[model samples]
Target: MFIRNERSIKEFIRYYPVVSTIIIIHILTWLLDIIPIGLFNQLYHLGVGSHWGLQNGEYWRFITPIFLHGGLTHMLFNSFSLVLFGPALEEMLGKAKFLFAYIGAGVLANIATFIIHPSILYSHVGASGAIFGLFGVYVFMVAFRKNLIDSQSSQIVMVIFIIGIIMTFLRPNINIYAHILGFVVGFLIAPLVLNGARPYYPPQYRKSYDDDGEIRFDPNRWKKKRFSRKTKQNFLWTIIIILVVIGVLYNVF
Candidate 1:
């Protein structure tokens, strides 16, 4: 299920460093193609299928392929989805758990891809499989607990999935099989990850009290009051600077 309230961008960035790092890697890979050192090329080669499958000695290709993307569009779209879904999942599950889920899902997705298309030697890349896993977790978390996912957010996810399906049919080069397989695997595995996890409490549900043992009914009093305006402004500017740095790195090597 999706978050009920809009998370502040700052809060999101703070909780999702792994997501941000992966996106940065995608952008850097694209920008580094302009360099002549062949570093990006080397990484690309290392990340591809590499004659590795269920039969090959290099079985790691099942997982490594998720970190590689064929082109700028592939990288951008996958990274965008990661950013959209990563933070919420990370917030719900701790960073370490989220990371495990992502990598595990990626590996499973790659294995499925290899099993179905063993003879095809195309270099596979992008975070779609992992994103699919995140979607799987989201759907599972919500479906099992209807209160977790609000109606609006559920509709949004459905719309996105529909769009993805349409794009799969329209785009000849798109790997619809991989996407479907990844999604299925992710959905199947999410419940296991969430087993024994406690239900999340919305911020609104948490109440504060006064020294007199009276419940503080004023909503404004519940708002975070520690930070001064100047402090908040400085933090906002800092976030802006960080975002700018990420954008620059995305565009240039």
Candidate 2:
């Protein structure tokens, strides 16, 4: 279910426009943040999840921080997680439902973070909360809707989730409240959104007919030669793990 089969960047965007848009926003926001323009600096400050901002009725901080990142590492990790897992849920739940779940979880997580940490200096950023919300949806499926996800994918989800939680505590400048709250919100809302949801299916290739009136099928006409799907999934997870280790080391040193 986590496999991505789009043949090109265009196809990938067309197939999963919601996820694509989110990643694009993440990149653009990060770029604006790093730029030294005065207005962009105000944009970053206005968007950060600051307790003072929330207390002063700058409520949009709850939603805006989801697209903001503290650094390149923060944005890349969250964006990669979205790219790795967002497409399947987007496909299964349809665009509207998936978007609601994602943004809802993020907003609620920020609210919860504000409630739990009332200090005026407290602030955080990144899409980790919403990404954890996605994990929450997968956790619900693995526990209650087993038929929707294969056992292998279920195993992957559980393993990655455990690692994520561990890293939440280990990593510096992390928002523990947002991560946990986002996950809880996602799990709680899963049943409502997942109702009548279907399993994700990769893009299909059309069949061709020979001149002799026989139908011929090229199983991989649209797909390029690459690792088997199972291998690809494994490799993807391996790269995620490596990235996680690198992040940890970078933070430590």
Candidate 3:
């Protein structure tokens, strides 16, 4: 199990430069902090959270916070999660969609944080929000396409999600809302990003169990609906509906 995933991660990163660049940028930011260079340090501070980052016309901060970290430990933990889950997701969704989902989730997480806690005047930094976004994609994909993974893998994935959510509450000074909102955005937008990217069951696995729970493998009994381009278009329509509803609510007096 681990071996296959490891091989896939390597292949995914080798073929895709976006994930590698993100990881490198995060590491470089950490290194920059330790080196204490004047100009590099000055640019590094751009990622540190600011309440008016969006309002002050420094819109980059919306996405930059996902690369910044509070400390070495913070960076390490986030880096671990990123490499563990980010690559496969990028492979599944394709680079452009994956990048959009990540940045979009982080931006919404930050936006939600501000709306929910307007008085909390502290600089936020960390990739946990974006990491949780990847986690969210994993969860949604698992829910939609259970045949893609085994039962054991699904159990581990659920346990990780449960433990991760619990940790957000147990740890102080952590923005639980950001993680939650990131997850929500990831869950909602993943279907649209997937957009016909789901893996289909093979011909041989189309078998059914007997009344006493006996196993059989038949190659001809095909019953599942085809996940075609029309299905992808329906998901895109759902995304549009959701966005239109949210926009109306936000702007309506």
Those runs of model 3 whose alpha carbons end farther than 4 Å from true positions after fitting are 1-12, 200-253
Query: 89-155, model 2: which lDDT tens digit per residue?
Result: 9988999999999999999999999998899999888998999999999999999999789887898
Candidate 3, which ten residues in sequence have the lowest lDDT sum?
1-10
lDDT of 3 by residue, 40-70 (tens): 8877787776776655677677778888886
Count: clashes, candidate 3: 0
Query: lDDT score, residue 205, model 1?
Result: 39
TM-score of 2: 0.88
Between prediction 1 and prediction 2, the one with superior TM-score is 2
lDDT of each: 0.64, 0.87, 0.68
lDDT of 3: 0.68
Scored against the true structure, residue 158 in model 1 reaches a CA lDDT of 62
- TM-score per prediction, in order, is 0.71, 0.88, 0.72
- Model 2, runs deviating above 4 Å: 205-230, 233-237
- The prediction achieving the highest lDDT against the true structure is 2
